[model samples]
Target: MYKIVKPLFFSLNPEAAHHTVTGGLQRFTKIWGAKSLLKNLYTVEDKRLEREVFGLKFKNPVGLAAGFDKNAAYIEEMAGLGFGFIEIGTVTPRPQPGNDKPRMFRLVADEALINRMGFNNQGADVAAGRLKRLKNKNGLIIGGNIGKNKVTPNEEAVNDYIYCFNALFDYVDYFVVNVSSPNTPGLRDLQEKAPLTHLLNTLQKLNEQKESPKPILLKIAPDLTDSQLDDIVDIVRDTHIAGVIATNTTISREGLQSEDALVQEAGGVSGKPLTKRSTEVVRYLATKSNGAFPIIGVGGIHSAADAIEKLEAGAALVQVYTGFIYEGPALVSDICKGLLKNK
Candidate 1:
């Protein structure tokens, strides 16, 4: 069904199609028994998919990656589509038009996407409000992936993160600090040692004061070197954050099967070409962190094999973005069931 819908969707602007599909899903579930209807198509509840991390028990390990439902709009609908978890936002303290429209593109030839969406989202407060209304069930876990606005300069980015952290604290099961996306201007600079440590430490300090501190994880880029990853290990240990999501999108264009011009389209590359590099990052982080921190692996995972590869690489959980777009809802069940099978 997604294969059939892909052409029609691909015909529209990537961002527009995204809203249309998400909005449609939101409405689709409102009809009587619609969720049950989707369950027949996409649902799979199996023990192998159950994962425990950061004192939270996931119903399943396959989570919809952040940036898919940036505002927490389709949590219930997507949850019905068989993801054990869904992460929303890279939301900021304030809403802003992200980089201009053509910012999102498909490299279908490579089963990939290049997006400079720039953390475009409704403010954290709004997303938190939406999440607050959702009836929490043990079946799904939702993570809030937070980022600063493009207008927030690197030096003061921690304030923006703190705002989001405080706002979303009660609503999400976990939080991902996103300083790694390649889209927002000067955002990646926060990944450097001193600044990165400062940001995570600020959040962890705030988290400690809460009666039930949310699990905080840092989302990183695949472009970091060994020394940088070592720095990340140091940051995670020193700050005592929950874990790391090893890897956001990558800036690397190597081995892309897409046209040269298309590959050169400016943005972070995500999908098939990202698999190896992302997995490598996951493995590297796992090795460096020495199981002291958990990892949520994302990037280029499109199948059961791909999902398992991340688990084998030491991911406590895995997320899908472009793969979900290209392969559709069935991908979730496939990955989950595959996890069950191997177990």
Candidate 2:
């Protein structure tokens, strides 16, 4: 199916192709049995695939990472293609248009994408409202990946996270604090030890106040040094957040096979170029923390073997974004099938 349409999609610009697929999927769902057809073709159901992580039960460990469905608009559409979970947003307290045109570029040769989207999303309240009305999410675990608006100053960043956390609290199963993305200006600054610790601790304080506190996981960047990773471990322990998502994207461009122009384009790189580094980050976090907390491994998961490698490195679950694009919708079921085979 994807093979047939891949070329047509590839013909359009990266961003346009994205909108085309998402829009097409939205219209596709209007047809009766469309969802059932997708499920039968793409899903692999089994008792063994179930995962219980961070006080939440997932039908499988495979999840659609943030940035794909930023507005929570396609939970039903994506759910039909079979996913244990779907994370919505890198959304902010207020909607922002993000970076200028040509912000997203496809490196087809490298099977990667470079996006400096700068947290282009419709705001937490809009996403929250959409999630509020989402009805087809039967067993799909939803995660809210929250971030501060680009215009929000670092001093007031805590308030941005607070607004998103409180707004999406009722809708999502878990929360991901996104201070890792390299796109947003000064956003990654919060990933520093002191500010990062303060942010997580503040959120943790609010979380504890609730009768049922949900898991709050921190997302880190691949560019961090060993010393910084150590700080991450300490921060997690000190704040008592749920776990970590080992890596958002990389700012490095060491050995990419893509052309110089695309390679030189500024943005975080995600795809085959990141596979080894991402797994290394996951392993580092898992080992450094001595498996003290769960880790959601995400970065260049293109196949089941990739997913398994992340798990073997100590990730409790794994997510896909670039892989989902380069490999297609069947990638989820393929990974599930591979997991079943390995089991």
Candidate 3:
């Protein structure tokens, strides 16, 4: 059980444990039809759990958020883990080492994580190749969360996004434009209206050319102002882009059970501390857009109640990253079951 494995995983360095768990799951799936077995245990087939958003059909509304399977490494395994979908990557155009080690830390007491991982990925091209081969077939929705590299200047950020966008076009079900991460220098600058809208329009132009154009959604940080979110709504309409992801992660450290030194260790804070802000963003988007566009809620979802709150707040679907880390794979089925109950 994940409960038994949680402490052992927590004992190791966060990054190392991530690789170990992913690798182990990948191996497990390779032998004896692992994913199928997991589906038998975790997946609940109920029409109420099905959702259609941004032209994609999700078997369930509960998804594993981006940053969990950055390289598209464990898609099938994660899909088997009962996630209705999985969003992979904040992948850059070119692969980079990302920030230095010890960039990911756990504030266990707060049931949260602070990551300055700086888009550590194997690049868009590499990810696209893998995704092309390991495509999902069991109605498991997959989203590609794309971003510019840390070294890329803000002025030329659009080029980086374009590269990833073009590369991943044939593979992913949806796209999440991620310019909200706090670790990348000057990255947040892209969140401003002009740069953000321009970048999205360019991608939209390129996406329109494809016979079957994919949904393009922007992922904003929880720290943005109401004015910024208003700009986002305006941009979404202007560019004819699909929708919004509501949040990436927050730079704020407010309302923490963790000590100041622990919380101040540097990086974006996610988990319980992010719940309110992220949900607020979702509600604001729902209200501002007047339900014109859909929203995929992400941030501090730790329970079925959190997932449902996002739906009630107007998210067409919902995702969990920090919650999965803190609560385990069972959280996926729990949310799905709760949704079924509510229905």
Listed per model in order, the count of residue pairs whose N, CA or C atoms clash below 3 Å is 0, 0, 0
Task: Please provide, for model 3 over 1-343, each residue's C-alpha lDDT reduced to its tens digit, 9 standing for 90 to 100.
Answer: 8889899999998889889988888888888777778889887788877888888888898888899989987888888878888999989999999999889999988999999999999999899988889854588888999999887888888999999998998889999999889999989999888898899999999998999999999989999999988999999999999999978888887788887778888899989888888999999999988999999899899999999998899899999988988888888999988988888
**TM per model?**
0.97, 0.99, 0.97
Compute the lDDT for candidate 2.
0.93
Q: lDDT per residue, candidate 1, 95-119, as tens digits?
A: 9878877898899899999998888
Candidate 1 pairs with clashing backbones: none
User: Which segments of candidate 2 are over 4 A away from where they belong?
Assistant: none
Each model's lDDT comes to: 0.90, 0.93, 0.89
Reference-based TM-score, model 1 = 0.97
Tens digits of per-residue lDDT, candidate 2, 198-284, equal 999899999999989999999999999999999999999999999999879899998898899999999999988899999999999
- Give the clashing pairs for model 2: none
